[model samples]
Target: MKILFTSFLYLIGGFFTQSVAQPARHRAAQDSLTAELEALRVQGHFNGFGVAIVSGKGVLYQQGVGFADAQAGKPYDLHTVQYIASVSKTIVGLALLKAQELGKLHLDDPIDQYLPFKVRNPAFPDVPITLRHLATHTSGIRDNDFYLSKNYYLRPGLPLAGLPMTFDATQTFIPADSAVSLPEFLRNSLTPEGKWYQPKGFSARRPGELYEYSNVGASLAAYVVERACGQPFPAFTKRYLLRPLRLRDSGWSFRQIDFARYSRLYGSTTVPLPYYATTTYPDGGFISSVADLSKYLHELIRGYQGRGTVLGPASYRELFRPQLAAGNFEDRNERNPFSESYNVGILMGFGYTGFIGHTGGDPGVVALLFFDPTSGIGRILLLNTSYDDRPSEATMYQIWNTLEKYQHRVGG
Candidate 1:
């Protein structure tokens, strides 16, 4: 009995030693990665950005470098919140599936069944557009010039003259009071009978026949979910998605989160931009931090591996299943890891190299979220500054590639 007890003590000590050694190694790797990223940020053009490496189990590494508000000397850290642009569409995709699971709606059902106003392609009026068509970006809806002009509004009380105006003029901001409801905005943008309607708003292709990415189309899908579930889109997502994941810092609007942690967006490294909100909020308006998003990415990785908690294995399978063919895209971006256009699974994107994720760029924000299925590793990059020049764009890719280099080390 004395010999057996001695053996058990030896095993316990070995177990603790091994566990301690693992974290010590991880910390060393993390420190090395931090140094490299800091060097890259100093040489790069963007003012602030954050990165996260995640796997099926949990977040491996997450850090923010540079300034979230340079003028104020605020360090951009893992908790700094900012818009993630079109990556928000993935949430819409998940919500749609969750709605379907609850028997609130079906993907195959025509969108007209839920919308208050009629929506049809003027070029193909006889053909019906289904929820699946919207989810897959084959609804034949187009974001005409009016979309850029009418969709963005400055948050009330922000002075316009203080903001950078050098980007696309259509991205210019309007007064907050002028903003309309999502349903009203879609009605005006899509129906021929409304004021903002242009024939160009509906693409020449028939619904579900071509892959034309449209922000309006994505918002429309969210609206359909809103109507079918009989709840506001924001509330529905909060109840079903954000709460379950404990993403307290993520939301569609500034009102939903702690305003103090929000990062200031920039048009250029030196040009601070005023806060603006999109009327089509569902398309590109999710605000989150690397810390929160790292967890979300872990959940996604788990979902892909059939071990997710937010949705059933069957729902996740449907979410990630490739819904299009090579013929779906008239011009597929096969080489870019950031391009979600290679092929689509619901609203999710598959890159040429089998990287499943999405890319987003709004006026002053750029974001990339992708996971490699083969290794079960995922990456998230969120920048508060726009890449308006070729050098800046290259730097963006460099930062992403740098993360790729250290992912294995940090995650191991």
Candidate 2:
């Protein structure tokens, strides 16, 4: 009788264990992914990462992981800031909209009207370039890359008269063969003038022919900001976005000392020349935190339509709306697990339900901002090195999937 009773007890214990435990598939997948991510982190693979989720004017997800500076043992957190490259364009676009709202400029205003510089091309004399053209990348001008491929040389970057610099660059970019600024660069390539210049054998076509990415377009667009606001790009951004949004820890400028508190860039090892300063600061510059970015997304989502303080709702709506579709991007081929394909254009970007914020990737960082029009929701992901030193756009989309699923629970 005792033996029989013990057998029954054992059978009952097994039954309860099976009933209470998590499903095998769920446990296995979670455990596997967790182990993989942890292993990657252990090998000093993930330098730092920050993510924020917002719902109902509240932050539902503000989390950080990995190290800000592993050498000193500083940890990544909500306060940790990182360089967000091309993502700056979206912010610059907002500044332009604000300028238009203030009546200092118009999006449709031609570039020559606001800028001191003029394009040397006479073929398109009747086709004047406008802020709308630059904003939409239809200005028919080439990006800095075209100029860079021409002047690939070493030269001192001295400030030319009659130009408002977007950011400070220690070294000037060359076109692989020629050394000259945009104005000088144009003269050499198109007009057949400049020292030791050889043409790449291309001409600036008429505006609105098709989509072409241009750092020059971005810079010129920001120059419009300088023209409208009478301040450097950084100073004007602070007044319009940072101050009004109450972003306490975010700024458009950084110091050499900032490297101490700033998250170091890494690609298997720290970048030997991991500098963020560039002439295209309006295009791919600015350092910010995840927490502040979440709020920035919030402002974009509400369009300041009487819901937030950063911008007037009508003006905010204009910023988030896609102004142009410049190109189609194939995201599936990205090497990074987090890579996502986003087609970029002047004055416009999109994802789900029309225009969804923006995304950017640079030397050691890849970032994304998400906003759902149907739900008026937004989130941000800022990582030190793309997950595992690769572009992690897909990983970001997964994170978006997770948060959007949980959003309904939090009234998002």
Which one is best on TM-score? 1
- Off by more than 4 A, model 2: 1-44, 120-123, 146-204, 256-260, 269-273, 304-308, 325-346, 352-355, 386-412
Whole-model lDDT, model 2? 0.54
Candidate 1 lDDT for residue 128? 94
User: What digit string (tens of lDDT, one per residue) describes model 1 on residues 318-404?
Assistant: 999999998888987665544557788989977677878787888778888888888888888888898777777778777777777
Q: What's the CA error at residue 405 for candidate 1, in Å?
A: 0.6
Per-candidate TM-score against the hidden true structure: 0.93, 0.70
Give all candidates' CA lDDT scores.
0.82, 0.54
For 234-340, candidate 2 gives per-residue lDDT tens digits of: 78888888888877777655641244457765543343123334434566667888767776766665562347565577766666555544243212222332222
Instruction: Write down the TM-score for model 2.
Output: 0.70
Worst 10 residues of 1 by lDDT: 6-15
